[model samples]
Target chain A: MSPTCKLTYFDAMGIGEPIRFLLCYGKIQFEDIRFDFEKWPSMKPSTPYGKVPLLEIDGKKMHQSAAICRYLGKKLGLAGANDWESAQIDMAVDTITDLRLKVTEYYWEPEETTKQKKKETLLNETLPFYMEKLDALVKENGGYLVAGKLSWGDFFFAGVSDYMDCVVQFDITKDHPNLAALKKKIRELPAIKEWISKRPKTTL
Target chain B: MSPTCKLTYFDAMGIGEPIRFLLCYGKIQFEDIRFDFEKWPSMKPSTPYGKVPLLEIDGKKMHQSAAICRYLGKKLGLAGANDWESAQIDMAVDTITDLRLKVTEYYWEPEETTKQKKKETLLNETLPFYMEKLDALVKENGGYLVAGKLSWGDFFFAGVSDYMDCVVQFDITKDHPNLAALKKKIRELPAIKEWISKRPKTTL
Candidate 1:
């Protein structure tokens, strides 16, 4: 039998959404446990690294969003065909994550002056640089993120795109047609569509 | 036959050493290409995402340090015995990466006052919290990072520990005996020892 799975995270979609996407893509039934800032202090100590987006499979708690995504991707046949292919997928996922983090660092900056500077760099420099490269990848790979076919990297990027947009106050898909199409394709998948429609709504 | 391999990174260890360790552990001979800061401007445009630690195997250049390390680890039979074990190792590696980044943020801070504040928290809170948790993990897993056996995560931690310590000006092993022993075990491995003795020397 499939092990009982439960994923815990904040109500808003951040890193948690990618993991949720993977589970939904695989059609795996899991308890979507969400909480808020008020409950975080009490819950932090129980976590392995005081971070959420934790996955409990058969009562074994697992942390780190990337690791959990790869595990599920591998189990569900969404990683790749072999080690080399999986490596390509992993590289793409990491790249997407790198770009995501660049946006987030600025988004969460406390001081207004520093935050504005970061935002300027992110918009004028970082975002365009990454978006162009990623657009080329999607176009070259026939509309998928890596390995020329659907993989968890695609799910991951699609899942986090909304949060990224909200954080940056910009539509990442703005001139990146290939990436926009890829996101649309992934979102339209039956399982993902169902999950998106029912998942808790949040601004970010 | 093993595919011809080449690793290109800065003259420093930083993120490149773990991949080097994996290749050496498996006795896979490859070209180790090191470059200086002056050469980076010209080289940056050639990289996938304007980063170093690029690994080229059979003319296929792959970027992303974590992805390259995982690929090498899997090929070298050091990733894990199975999917679940690989996931466990990935978690440990990611967790270590998180702590490493925390130290780096403060270490690279330009303002003295902010840097000092970050250092205070790091030394008083961040370092101890992560070190204690990681130490317990190594002890429980019997001198390895995960799955109760040697894995790529062990190599990654050992390989990066010196850089991390140098940046933060602290001996992480001082209070974490189990982690210390684990590092010793990895460094003393015949292959890793040979690599360490012969590898390029750098402060970080």
Candidate 2:
């Protein structure tokens, strides 16, 4: 029997986008469950940690976007074959999520002063640090983040970098040529490109 | 040849403790490397993402405590058995880390007014939400966070809850009785109990 997979999240790109992208690109059949903000309070109670992006598979619920992504990645053959490579994929994806959360802080800060400080920190401190590391990893693994193929990490980085460019008003790859190239390469993938173009456009 | 691992951080029970606990409890032999605050600037360059709790495995380096913990957890059979249970464990551990990071904000705010507001939010919003959810998960999984076994999520929660009790100046499990019991149960594990007793006591 095909497993029942339903993704619960608001109609935004926040955490749900990666899952959507992965499933769509892989042609995996699952429900793209979105919720109205008005319904979240009641819906929140059912979630594992009172957060969305919960994946219900075969009557079991799981939370955490990274965990959900990894599960889907493994199921879809996007994660690597062995434990070490899988850990490396997890490391890369988790790093992207960390950087994305930092960018989110720019939106969460109350005033111009705090937001400005955060923006500056992002530009000067956080972005370069992550970009350089990503560049090194891409270079080390021969342009892919994992095991010489397009693993979930590549898709995650592509999604995150795209979101960062759209939200943070900074060109992430301007300085890091290799990371820029990596994003471009992932974007050029036939299945990924098709999925990106045809995918539902939502504000997360 | 056995791979050698070295973990470097400040000699405190702050961010580095969870990784240390995982390493020790898993019986994985690794160097418990520490550094003085005075020497951090010089030390930061050697780290990826310019952060500590950096793990050097057989001459290769990896950063991010959660990533390291998850890697070691999988390596030592502490994560979970299959894809789904592993995802649940990851979700729980990451949620606790999220809550812990938010709690850290109480200390970082420079102004007393902001700190007070953050403290209030911590008390009213964050703590109860996480406590209730963790309590539910513990109860649902039959007194364990994941896989009906003592996974790293249990230890991660124990470390975070212990930190909350000691550092955040709040008894997290006061309302959540199941969470309180799970914490007690985790604390009484022979390996964890022995490690907790021998673990160097420090204030963050």
Candidate 3:
């Protein structure tokens, strides 16, 4: 067995939750390290980019949640075997990440005018566009995002859909039948369902 | 031989440059596709996220510059072989990406108050901090980002440092000796140098 992993983040789910879910579902033992706001100042300097979701494998620390998740996926044999599948998986995850970043900008905007504009753009343009593409990809790939198998990208997409539903007040899956079916299928996976049920609740 | 690859983006050496460099350096045959502002609106809707730097492999389209770069890296044997090395490469690339996004925000802020605040935070807190860590990592990993060989992460970092030097009035590599050395090393590579010389020059 490999050395145990340690993940550091704030108490909230935010960027770190998907990684936590992957680890738990893979049955990998890891330390779920958390920090309070008061402690972040001291902790900030120690991280690569002074951000959370740093992963410690054995004794060496690695930062970036996407990188961490990819590493865990490879380690757990969740990433596909060949180059094409790996590329496809990376593509799908990157798409989800792109959507998530837009959502992040909505939260970070301080002015009501800019925030409203962003929200309008998201609601009117971004949301439906991504939903349509995701739905199409799901259908094209035989109900999976890549290689027609359960890969990390599927989980990442499911997580993003769940987040959008929670934060954007949009019933993402409901609007896109394929996406809705994909989410339901992912949730019904025995290991994933068990992991979701047993995992600690997080406030993002 | 594989079918010809075509990449489309703005004429500038922005996000599209990395994929261009990777493909050219790897001796992969690809069409260097570019466009101006007049073409962007009509072209935008065709993109997956209404963004550029899309790659067409064997006539199949792919979006997201990072994902395209990673896919090309794998095709060109630029990404590391094993899980650990691949993770290190990905982590480094992702860290650079994080900093780039923050830097982009500086340009996008419309308010002077917010812009000033972002500039101060970035220069005083974020910039030097990331440089120091990157310098240490480059040194620790034997002058390459992963497993002592030139990986896609090295190119990604070089592209970032080059962009900072071009756009921002600050000397990004001067403060960090290892980072400066790494950049120089990447620049000195024959294939990279040749590709750089031949690359289309444009203002982003």
Identify the superior model by lDDT, candidate 1 or candidate 3: 1
Q: What is the alpha-carbon lDDT for the whole of candidate 3?
A: 0.79
Better of 1 and 2 by lDDT: 1
Tens digits of per-residue lDDT, candidate 1, A2-113, equal 4499999988888999999989888788988999867999999999888888999756778899999999898888999988889989999889988988888998899899
lDDT of 2 by residue, A62-97 (tens): 778787778778888988888778878988887898
The lDDT per prediction is 0.88, 0.79, 0.79
TM-score of each: 0.96, 0.91, 0.91
Show pairs that collide, candidate 1.
none
Per residue, candidate 3 scores C-alpha lDDT tens digits across B59-158 of 6688777878887788788889787888888888888888887777775688899899998988887788788888888889888877888898888888
- Clashing pairs in model 3, backbone N/Cα/C closer than 3 A: none
How far residue A138's Cα lies from its native spot in candidate 1, in Å, is 1.1
Native contacts, share recovered per candidate:
0.94, 0.81, 0.89
lDDT of candidate 3 over A1-204, digit per residue (tens): 644788888875677777877877787788888877678899887766778888887577887878888887887788888876887888888888888888878866788998999999988888888888888988898888887777878777776666666567667778788778778887787777887787666544
Q: Report the CAPRI category for model 3.
A: medium
User: Which prediction has the highest lDDT against the true structure?
Assistant: 1
Q: What are the candidates' individual DockQ scores?
A: 0.89, 0.73, 0.76
Which regions in candidate 1 have their CA more than 4 angstroms from the true location?
A: A1-3, B1-3
In CAPRI terms, model 1 is classed as: high
